[model samples]
Every structure is written in structure tokens, then in C-alpha cells.
Target: MKDKIILKVETAGTRVDAYLASCLKEYSRGYFQRLIDMGHVLVNSQKTASSCRLKEGDEIEIIIVNKENKIKPENIPLEIVYEDKDIIVVNKRPGLVVHPACGHPEGTLVNALAGHFKGKFVPYLVHRLDKDTSGVMVVAKNEKVKASLVKQFQNRTISKEYIAAVGGNVSENEGRIEAPLGRSHQDRRKIVVGPLAKKMAITEFKVLSRHSGYTVVAAHPITGRTHQIRSHFAFIGHPVLGDETYGGPLKIGEKSFERQFLHAHKLSFTHPSKAKKVEFSAKLPKDMAWLSKKH
Candidate 1:
């Protein structure tokens, strides 16, 4: 069996494989290159190479070979913040994967939502957070709700606030990072800011407090790029503590962190069912709270 996807190029001058990876973040650029090699990708109704540069308004069609495996419901505990007919909001704990992928097939937030809903409606993911970043996340109950929330995110109308403790004392009280982000050429899993960057990423941050050599800051990402906050801070030489991938130290003096010291403190978006604005907030976990107080 196979599934087909069609996409229209919004921006020009990007490689086909890179464009595909940007549109579907679940898959990697290498995976798309393999698909193109296998003749499963077509541009403008003709089979195209992975290095093909896309023009604005170019049509891309992909045929993905389906696997037999399906996501199974698992009895995992979830901290439900808000629930309604249209959506469900959860304060996702750190270390929990948002969905199943190649390496992680179970024990994810999606599987937990599946089990929680059980015979009820299936959960539809609208957005995602990193595995090590604990945060407030929203899930749609149906496609209609998912479309509405996704559109809000696309239009940059949704508001997201995050708190993070980064290495080094930030001199600026408030500042904005306007950098372009894309997958690293050396490491596919990592994101970096440079000339090869494909998308514009913006993050505005304000210093909450200064402690020893570290600083606690509130970050608001204007663009919903992958690892936007983490990469932006790291680009400014202030990586989030415990985020070793971005050059952050694991141990700050006597204190040690198991995961990135970042949290999605608040999120605001218009309700899909009701035409009113709504907001959700999640408290900082024990480790972060303790570290903040100790320093």
C-alpha cells in the first residue's frame, strides 16, 4: 500500500529534498533523497531529482510506501489541563515523546491520548514540543478543530511563551534574535543559523533574573521553526543549560540537570469551538524551580 502527498512550493530557490523536509518535519532530508532516488517524487508532474531547485508555484507530489505497523494505545498517565469537545490541553512532562517515530514506537503522548480517548474520538496533533522540553501543548479532537488551530499557528496569530535558564549572564534586559535556521550540514538532527539556513526564525526574550553565571529569561518565538528558541539562544552564546547539543554544560557548579532547562510557560490562541481568546499555562517543574531558587 502507498500514500500520496501533494505540495505547492511557496518559496523558490530551495532544493526539493530540503523543501520536503521543511514541509514534513517528521521525515529527514536524507529520507526524501532516498525517495527521490526511488522515483517516488515528482515535480511539475515529472520525476525530479533531489537536488532540483523549486520555483514558486511548482507542484510536488510524493508517493510514500506504507508500512503495516500502526500506532497502539498505551496506558500512560497524562496531566490534563483543559478538555472539551473540540480540544484537549496537557502539560506534557519532560522525557515523553510527542509521537511515535523510527526509534520511538511507543510510550509517547499520542499513544497516551489514544488510550485516554479509547472508544472516544481520536486525537489530532496541532503542534509539537521537543522530547526534553516540558511544556503546555494542545491537541485537537477532530479534523475541523485541527485545521482551525493549524491555520492560527500558520498565520502567526497564536502566542507562545517559554521560560529558560541559559549559561552566562545575559547583559541585555530585552532583545530580539532574528536569525535564519536550517538543518546542520554536518549533523542532520541538529539545527543551526547561517547562510544555508532556509527559514527566518525570530525570538524575543527578556531577562527575568540573573544568577551567578546563568540567566533566567522569558522567550517568545515569533516564528514556529524547529528548535527556534534553543538555536537562537545558542547562536547568541547563551545555550540553555543541560542542552548539550547546543554547547550547554550539564552541570552548573554543584547543580546538575538531566534535561534542557526550558519550559512552555504559557500559550494563547483563539478557541476553535468558541470565537473567543483562551490561554493556558503550566508551572515549572521541581528541578527548574529548585535551580532558580538555589542560584
Candidate 2:
């Protein structure tokens, strides 16, 4: 299917690609630039360069060509928390990959969503939870909703809370970890607390309960980063239990865990279409809940 978008420029001097990206928040400037290069974008009925400056009242047209989706829909079950015309909230289960990747080409959440919404609408991911992390997640039903949600994430207006079972006793009732995180030089796959192309990562946490060898803490990541909570806790010598990559023990006492003890417990953000604040919570899975009952 091909969709055409036409816009009349209100502000002048902005580049065509930039203007289009701003107007159609769902697409990126680079994407618009590619369209311009392919002669799919036009200004006043004439093909134009991506860098061409726009004038007030200039009529711009964008032709979006949809390609055949290669990802097949699978009838995988999902724990849907809430759904509406614009978005779907789900309590993502552990060990489920959110999106398809190199080794994980199918059986993903996206594929399942496709199956669920088959013939209705395509699901657009605004944010992601790790493959092993179980928690509240939201998916947009359309590009307009996706753009609004993406903007909220970019502005850090979306609030998130996580429950983590980490090794060792946390001395303080609450504390903040303000550290920079970047990809490890030695391991491209690993993220670490360092200055190598670093971006500031901050995590504020409160000790919820203390157990024999571990502590369950409520973590609020002030700034999102790759593995921010795991990396920050590991930096403080308190790697999350079951996180082998971060030095966490696979077994704590008699119980064993197959994945890291991190759960996205709560998420809050402004509703894209409602223009109202909304929040969602996911109950702790059996494994994580098991730790809370222990003395």
C-alpha cells in the first residue's frame, strides 16, 4: 500500500528533510533524505533535494511506499494488560525476545502482535524491554501514536520503576548512582560504567527488603542507558542475582534463577491520544515474588 502525505510549510528556512521529519515525527530525517534522493518527495510538484530550504506556503508532498513484510505472524500467547484504539499495554513475560534479531528471527513479541492484530493494524514499538526482563510495555497501533510515544520517551517524561534482586545487603535505605556508561572497549557486546564515549546514566534506588544473601530494591532509572541498572549495581559491587554477565550468582542459597532478577514493575506516561497521564503495573513473576517471601 502507498500513502501520500502533503504539507504546506508554515515556517521558512528549514531544510526539506528536516521539515518533513519534524512534520512527520514517525519518520527520521535520514529517511526523508533517502526519499528525496529517490525522487519520492516533491516541492510544488517538482522533485527536490533534501537540503533544499523550504519557503512559507510551499506545498510538499511525500510518497511512502510500503514494502512486503518478511516477518511472519505467529500465534504466540501474550499477557495483554490493556488495549485501546491507539495503544496496547502488555505484561511482557520473561525470556521472550521483543523484536527479531540475527539469531532470533521469529517467535518474537512483534510476530505475536502481528498475529493478534492481523488485518487490523501494525504494531509499532515505542520502547523495549530486554529479552530476559519481564514488565509493563506499550506498543503503538499506528505511526501517529508511535511518534507521540517516542517523543515522550525522548523527553524522559515517561517514568519507569523496576524491582531487582541483587547480591549482598544494601546498607542504605535509599541512594542514587550517578555514573556514566558506555560500551566496553574489550567487549563490544558489554556495557560498562566508563568514560569511553560515555553518556550520563543515573539510577535512584530504595531498599525494599533484605534477605539472607540478597536485597530486593526498587530502582528508578533517571536516565536510560543500555543495561543502566545492571551496570550501575554491578559497579557498586552488588550485581543483580542471576546476572552471570555482571558477576551475579546463578544460584542464591537453594534457589536458582535462569535470568537476571530484574523486573519492570511500573511504567507511567502521558497517553498519546488521551492527553492524560496514565500508569500501568505488572505483578512480579513467580520467581521474583519468591524472593520477597524469604526472610
Candidate 3:
């Protein structure tokens, strides 16, 4: 099925990337602009630019191509923590793309899952973390479990927790970050907070450990906005380590690690099949594990 979204400009003086960033929570800024450049975005039913300024009363239409990439299944090993008839939980490693997309069509977890299950078992994503981020991910085996899990997420019933290595030594031991994040017009690749952005979003963070120049943090996001944790953390001037898109330089000396120092450490929700509360966790990857041990 063809996916789509319609947005009405609620406020004036907003740029195209900003407006769409507020509307398209699941898509990245670059992805949305690609849509605009490809003639998939209609300003009052006409194509527009990524930087086109918007005023109140402009209607925007966005067509989304969910079919990202055609990844073939490979016999890659998975860190499966839990599995049942309805659900399977995995510790997704960094650099493993969660789904298929045009930008990254091959070597994705979806293809591997498809191959693992083949025809007898089907796995649909209940939720997804970023490609550079690692941690616990839930996959639903059947439609009922998928629908229920999605509802739980939409209703904010599920609690998501993450761990990350930030760039600087954190001053706050514990605090909340409330930011209205929207996409950037200048870069068309980063997320920035703005007025009239969208509904309220909150992230609670605690300093798990502090080191000489870096700190490990635990993040609890009350709202699951796209790149919420990463964007909010970046706004606070402590972007995740190895996060290139969010002002991170190319990582070095961390051959044991790749991408960002982020992991989906925990997910808590109810099991749809057994009707019991369930919480799953993934151990820190080898690199982080080594670092933690050394520290």
C-alpha cells in the first residue's frame, strides 16, 4: 500500500523542513527533503523546495514510500534474549539497519529475520531503533501481537530505556530535557527544537557513570519522537559519541565500536499472547562492556 501524510500549516514563518519534521516524525530530515525534491511533496498540491518558507493556511501533502530496500537474508548471528509464539526480542547490534530502505537496501536485520523465519514464521517490527543505535528490539510474529504492541506504544503504555556515551562530563546527575525538536533547514539532516513545533516531548536522564572526559547516561523518553533521545541530548550540548549526523566527528580508536555510543537497554510492555507484563534487556555490546569493565 502507498503511504501518505497531509499537513496543514498551523503557524506562519516556518520553513519546509521544519514543518515536515514536525509532521513526519518517523522520517529523517534528508529523507523528507528527498521526497520534496522528488516531487512527492505538494504545497497546495504543487511541488516546493526544502527551504521554501511557509505561512499559515498552506496545505502540504506528503507521499511516503515505505518500501525502503530489498535486503536479502543472510546467516548472521543474532543475540536473541527472549522468544515466544507472539514475540521475539533481540539485541540489535550497531551498524545493523533495522529495516529495508532505498538508501540502505541490503544487509539489514529485516532480511535476516525474513530468511530465519522463511515461510512458516513471519516477523513484523513492533518498533525500531536507529541503525547506529544498538539494543533490545521487539518483533511480532503475528498480526494480533503486532497490533496490540503498536497500540501499547501509541498509548504510551510501554516504557523504553536507553544507555549512551556522551561527549562531555555531565554536570547534572539527574534531570529532565523538554525540547520541541524539529528538522533543520540549513543542514536538512539534523533535528532542532523550535516554537510551534509540535506537542510536548520529555526525556528524563540520569548520569550512570562519569569518567575523565566522558559520561555514560541512562535515558528514559516519555515520548518516542523520531530521534528524540539523540536530538534532545545533542541540544543539551552532549551529543552521543560517534554520532556523525548530530555533530559527531568520525569515531577513532574505538575499533571495538562503530556508530553512536547508544543502546536500547530495556523495553517494558505486556505480552499479548500470554497477557503478562514483560520486560527485556540487552547487555551492553562488547565495546561498551569492555569499557565499563576497564573503568
Query: Whose lDDT is greatest here?
Result: 1
Best by TM-score: 2
Candidate 2 per-residue C-alpha lDDT over 145-182 given as tens digits, one digit per residue, 9 for 90 to 100:
98899888889999999999999999999999998988
> Mind giving the per-residue lDDT tens digits that candidate 3 earns over 158-186?
99999888877789999999988776667
| Quality of model 3 by C-alpha lDDT | 0.76
lDDT of 2: 0.84
For model 3, the stretches where C-alpha displacement exceeds 4 angstroms are: 1-71, 249-258
Ranking by TM-score: 2, 1, 3
User: What TM-score does candidate 2 get on C-alpha atoms?
Assistant: 0.78
Q: TM-score of every model? A: 0.78, 0.78, 0.73
Over 4 Å off, model 2: 2-67
Query: RMSD to native for every prediction?
Result: 7.0, 9.5, 8.6
What is the number of backbone collisions in each predicted candidate, taken in the order shown? 0, 0, 4
Alpha-carbon deviation at 290 in model 2, angstroms: 1.0
- lDDT of model 1, residue 277: 100
